[model samples]
Target: MRPETKEITTESLGVLETAALLRELTAGLIASSDFDAALAQLARTSRDAIPGVSWCGVTVLRAGEPASVATSDVHRSDLDRLQYGADGPAMTAIRQREMILAEDLRRETRWPRWTRRALALGVHGVLSAPVDIDDQVIGSINLYSGRPGVLTASRQLTAMLLAEHAGLLLAAVRDRARQSELAGELDETLAGGEVIGQAIGVIMTQRRCSAQDALQVLRSASAALSLPLREVSERLVGSAARPRG
Candidate 1:
């Protein structure tokens, strides 16, 4: 038989335990290897962690465009529509860098198109929190529920905390990836430097020219060919190493 699992709810856990739960959830979000994976896990973990969150997802913003990155619901295209259409609480939260709420879509007058679609889908309420990194808004974490009044004061506080944790985790993940990319670039640069040095040595010996003159020749060739300095140097090195035939 399958093991009976119990829901870990805020009501069941005391203050200290709740803190630990939040930490564990935060750690889980950070444990992902990449930002994409982190966001995907965050959707599921936050839905499980935040009370009264029927659906949870992330909206990644770029160049003032909102894109649905991850979602807990199977029919998550709801978020995609809201993003592409550019009218939803998530977009509002991202713009304002604050929480946005639509307590009742049926009675909502702020966004008629969104309210109609949301009502049709049985999503009566929506709570969105801005995901910020270094005080800069990058996106939003959104929750949709069937109930009209979902995010009470206590829930809002918890959702904000979760959004902050997710934002920090994503930032760390992106930073790590950027560091790795820079490291790889450095390695390539060093290798290119070595090859360029070899090519310069070849030119100096063949033409009895100075190192500076040889480098100038290589640079001219690179400029004329519209190729990178590294590529030109690499080709020169290869030509010198080729067996006479």
Candidate 2:
């Protein structure tokens, strides 16, 4: 049978259910520290949160090429990899930016090789929901079931909702990580400035010279030692702390 592709509508989901999904996705973000962790959590969440989904995998465009980011179960990694480097539902969903469903892999005509192997792995049905990660990147949430007809329309709607929330949560996680990295850089810069200041103070006391002259001397020493100014400054500060025995 041919795979079904269509636009997802929210009419199948209730307000409280949607709210609960948002809460679950937010929890996934809070419980994660990086992109990979967040994606792994998302895969697990989708597998458990959506009814009839036995396995879940997340695939995203990395450097303009699709890469499998996470799978709900470690055993599903091989199954997910089967879709990569070949034409399959996940790629179709991502490329078309729509949901793709194969109600029965046995009768599925498209991607015969993939469906055949998927059946060997005990997957009888599949659902792929596209997620917009950012303006530049897109992804898909892939769900697999052990029996046919398990991936119903209502379940597809739920998976779609999960994908929407996951996109937002992942973007937040990425931004927060960027902010933390910048903060660490700022802290290092401030600490380095303090060391340079202390080194200049030591040079001023020893030679009775201006701060600018001390800095120039430090730079000259850095050149002679073939080391960075910051390293030279730290070494100078360390040596000045030792007693002149």
Candidate 3:
């Protein structure tokens, strides 16, 4: 017989235990370098922290497209993909930005296609909590169980907490990536400006003309050659540095 779902109260998970869980999750998130890695850590940690959860998966919007970023087991990727192929809890949770729960796949009438496939995969209960990364980006942290009624109220709370932390960590990762990109552009701009100044100085000396005239000459050459101003400046500077031959 299938074991009855355990309905443990939230009180069973005390303040101290919750604090320890937060610490562990913080360490896991800090060790991750990107959104995928951080969410994968949460999936793995949730499976161990929650009593009834047999596996976990995470789905998010990548470049405005839905993607399954993490799963506890390799085989579970099919289960998440099946949900994407049709309307299911993970997508529903993300769209509505709310929690979605199916107490038992056998009795679930909301998503027929997803339910049928989940039942075949031996997943009976599912709970999805939305992760709010930003105004434009949202996702879901999904918990799966092998028996009906295993997704208790307390476990749902735990899943919600984990999703919240995932959102914050993912936002940090995005911010870091944006910062790095901006820094690269800034460095390129400074280097290009320096080279352009050198080229202008060389032109001024060669033509015995004003700085403005030197810049105009460089611009005219750039337009005639159909090259970027930076490229033209780099070529001119390189040619000027060469010894007479």
Best-performing candidate as measured by lDDT = 2
In order, candidate lDDTs are: 0.74, 0.79, 0.79
lDDT of 3 by residue, 144-179 (tens): 999999896766767777788778887877677677
Off by over 4 Å in 2: 1-18, 31-33, 64-68, 82-85, 194-245
Model 1: per-residue Cα lDDT over 1-245, one tens digit each: 33333343435564554576578777776555566677778888877766677888788765554454788876854763454326778788877888887776777887777777777767888888988754333888888887887755556767777787777888887778778866864665477888888888989999999998997888788779998668988898898899999
210: Cα error in model 2, Å: 26
Runs in model 3 lying further than 4 Å from the true structure: 1-12, 63-68, 82-85, 184-245
lDDT of 2 by residue, 6-58 (tens): 22234434556667767887876974548878888888877777668899988
Error of 3 at 180 (Å): 2.9
Clashes of 1: 0
Error of 2 at 227 (Å): 14
Cand. 1 Cα-lDDT? 0.74
Write down the lDDT that model 2 would get: 0.79
